[model samples]
Target: MLTLQRRQLVGHDILLARHGNHISTMRVDRQAGRVVAYLDDGSVDSAPNLITPGLPMPATVRSVLREDWKFFAVATACTTGFAGVMVAAAVALAGLSGEPGMTQLLSAYSGT
Candidate 1:
């Protein structure tokens, strides 16, 4: 990853560009409206602007599936399986409690 940082040094704003173990410095010339990059070989390079705008990349369904389909599928399957187990358990318990089931339990608790 590339990271850019700015600091004030001796009344001048200096930009530091870091990538991995390599570090380089750049000087921001506000008066000239240009950014100067100092190279490792002691050569200076200048750019009109810091960042250039480019066209956006198109999103594809294959890319989306490649990135997250497995996770989504597993999550959905697990949720459905859990719900099925809970429903089956509730039905079994209701059957064991006889015809009234939860209604009978509630009436007994209410003393009516």
Candidate 2:
């Protein structure tokens, strides 16, 4: 639960190190009188030694958007199209049933 600023050191005062491609929040813990980096992925490293202080953290938001925005956009478009189709189908079914509201929907579901 440490609020780490960009390029901050993973010192004794800091309890976490947010770094890497996945932006993994590594927990800084003292074990056997040594500083350790506990990753959420269940890996551990010697924090003080392995991590270099004041190293610039990568901008994950920009990286993700740049690398994966096309996929995200495609997914969003597909979802929206599917929703539109569903709504249109429902409206058409309701109109065909000659009834309004839930009654039409119920009849359609009942196949009656």
Name the candidate that leads on TM-score.
2
Q: What lDDT would each prediction earn against the true structure?
A: 0.56, 0.56
The sequence of per-residue lDDT tens digits that candidate 1 reaches over residues 48-93 is: 4323336322345555567789998999999999989976776667
Residue-pair clashes per prediction, in order, are 0, 0
Q: Once superposed on the true structure, which residue ranges of model 2 sit more than 4 Å away at CA?
A: 1-59, 101-112
**Model 1, CA-based lDDT:** 0.56
- The lDDT, on a scale of 0 to 1, for candidate 2 is 0.56
Report the lDDT tens digits of candidate 2 across residue range 1-112. 3333443344533334333443244444435333555555777555462254465455555555787899999999999999899878777676677556654554455436
Query: How well does each candidate superpose onto the true structure, as a TM-score?
Result: 0.35, 0.40
Off by over 4 Å in 1: 1-62, 99-112
Which ten contiguous residues of candidate 1 have the minimum total lDDT? 11-20
Provide the RMSD of all predictions against the true structure, rounded to 1 decimal. Answer: 14.1, 13.6
